[model samples]
Target chain A: MLKKRIIPCLDVKNGRVVKGTNFVDIRDAGDPVDLAKHYDKAGADELVFLDITASHEKRDTMIEVVRQTARDVYIPFTVGGGIKSIDDMRAILRAGADKVSINTPAILNKELITKGAEIFGSQCIVVAIDAKAKGDGSYEAYINGGRVNTGIDVFSWAKEVEKLGAGEILLTSMDRDGTKDGYDLELTRQVSELVGIPVIASGGVGSLEHLYEGLVKGKASAALAASIFHYGTYSVAEAKRFLIDKGVKVRW
Target chain B: MIGIIDYGRGNMSSVEAALKKSGYKFVNTDDIGILATCDGYILPGVGAFKDGMEDLAKRGLDAFLKEVAKTDKPVLGICLGMQLLFDYGEEHGGAKGLGLIKGQVKKLTTSFKIPHMGWNSLELKRESSLLSGIVSGDDFYFVHSFKVVPDDDSVVVATCEYGEEIVAVVECGKIFGAQFHPEKSSDKGLKIINNFGKLVERC
Candidate 1:
């Protein structure tokens, strides 16, 4: 069987790794390239860099960040945030990122997903969904750093993107982010079952048991956490060992 | 110098970076003449099977690739590039491949997931130069929906389990194919590439 992936996400801002609480209160963690190498050594299945930079000049720096990270670390890496077009995807992939994640661009223009998949192949395109629960058994996709609600139902948008040829979905529970309570298992399980593509469950992981829950009960192909790994609460290798002991197969 | 074949698809930067890190000279070229001059070649690409074969055939690199396989010059195909080494594939309306390997590529019948993305441990089938330092249970990054179903089992160098017995690495004479991306698979991955470098150093 395919192994359940334990990914350490680096929320990068200004060439450094940073994380926030419920999408705010951002603070620095470490250098992206340094943190990337750390995670690689720690046995992370993959690494995700959410480039939170906003300036034009910094956009160039973010590309350099990807390049440095790719060179320093030898694992499948993904760069997201500020990616707007196929050309932007091209630059990141050229910088040596194995994949590129899109959220705002995907919500603003669903065609970006289709065009991206066409130009770069669906395997390299990841559609990130920050879904805020609507409290009516439905969730709305949020964009602009979880500040604006797209009003697009998460399930509908996920299915739409799959139809548009997205290879994977990075589904994060906005309400559960930074809670450390656990992943939104109900949401992840529902979404994972709804789509054929692999679903990466992001946001809200507090313990190795939580990782097991996410893989077993949440039904996610991969579990992505920021602070849990960044804060040294658990090394990815330790977490994988925990999962394996719990009868969850993982790549070690 | 190793020639990285540009089939008008996929990214070659990581492959070049890995080759450079391994201390081997490389040139990304579509010119078969330059390719013929190189010690060996690395075929790097990712995408649909039919589209990949079409691009290779369009540039006349399809026959050139087969010709290279005929010689002792090693050819390493990554991901979709690896799939194209087989006879044909069931992906994208059933396309014909280079027919270097005995079998055809078909969509994975595993009950697990599609694409099979993420890292998985390899089960080395037998000894080969490409797996010199690499051992069984070593993890490599894999991302693909279709896998080669070899008619002859002896070609398989390593197998990684993911529902069905997925072929991780295959070596038949001078041609080698990896379903995983060794370039992006961290240190263990580079070790595999380094072994290939040693194989090509003979030329």
Candidate 2:
């Protein structure tokens, strides 16, 4: 049986971790590589660095961060946000990051998904979708940090990406984000069932229960959280122990 | 020293880093001469079996690896690299493998999931040095769509369940293959790599 994965996402800005991290033992909490190494020690299954860098000139910093992390960390890690082209994907993967998640670019040029899959293999190409439920019970895909709505149906776009050779889907509920509420179970379960590829349930994950809910109730293959892990709410090992006690198979 | 084969396919960085952390000296090389110089070889890959085989052949590594497989020196294949050790595979219209191991790589026919991604615990079939210091049911990270079907069940030293008994580790007289990415599998994974390193050192 495949074990459910717990991924800690780090938001990067100008080569530094943007979100406030509360790991006291870490000398430089803002350092993505150090925090990544810290997370690996804490037993994180994988790590994701969402580069929210404003300037393109500073983008190389993220690559450097990825290079250092890959050199130091043994577990798999992913670099997302601001990745727009095949060349960008190449630089990141070449830096030793196991996978790269694309959102805006995937929505803008769906062909990138197919091309990345063809070039780098589908296992490395992850299509992340930011979804917001509409009043009519339909969810709409958003781009630009959920600021601009693409007006594309989340479900249909997910199916399209899978057809285009995306290996996994990182589904984030815009409505649930930052609420500390929980994952959009209906959104995650429906999408997980809708596609054959693994679905990583992201967004509103406030507690271990939420993570468990996302894995069991939402039917997501993996659960991703940032604040809960960063703010010292729960260690990855603790979360795994909790999941294990609840009978959810997770890597210790 | 171990030679990490670079065949123009798959993830080589993680293997290099893992070996380095395992305190083993290694070189990333495609040169058959350099690979021959190494005490052991680690074939790490993450891609299609057909592509992997084609890459090895294009680089003339297919023959070189086949030659190495006959020797006492260890040749550890990871993920797609492991599949390439098999005689044949059903991936991408079917393609011939390195034929080092008596097995065929076939698509996993399980209702659980395709690409059986993430961590899964191993079930020990028998005692082997590859799993030294590792407990039964120790979790190892795996990410693949196909599984190898060994011609002889005795070749299989370890198996993991994902709706069925999926081959995890196989050791046939020094030619070892791990369907999981031991490098990406964290501590226990590093231990396995170190065990292989120790085997190579012994040689």
Best by DockQ: 2
**How well is each residue in A1-252 modelled by candidate 1, as lDDT tens digits?**
467888899998878888989978898899989988888888888889898664234588789988887777787888889999888999999888988999988988989999999888888999999999999899999998888988999999999989998999999999989989899999999999999899999888888888888888999999999998888887787888888888998877
Model 2 misplacement above 4 A:
A20-29, A54-57
Give the 10-residue window scoring lowest on summed lDDT in candidate 2 chain B: B109-118
lDDT of 1: 0.88
Task: Write one digit per residue (lDDT tens) for candidate 2, span B77-118.
Answer: 999989899999998899999999898999998887677888
lDDT of each: 0.88, 0.89
Model 2 Cα displacement at A243 (Å)?
1.8
Q: Please, what are the lDDT tens digits per residue for candidate 2 over residues A118-232?
A: 8888989999999999978899999877778999999999999999989899999988876789999999999999999999999888899999999999999999998888878
What DockQ class does candidate 1 belong to? Answer: medium
Residue range with the least summed lDDT across 10 consecutive positions in model 1 chain A: A52-61
User: For candidate 2, what is the total of clashing residue pairs?
Assistant: 1
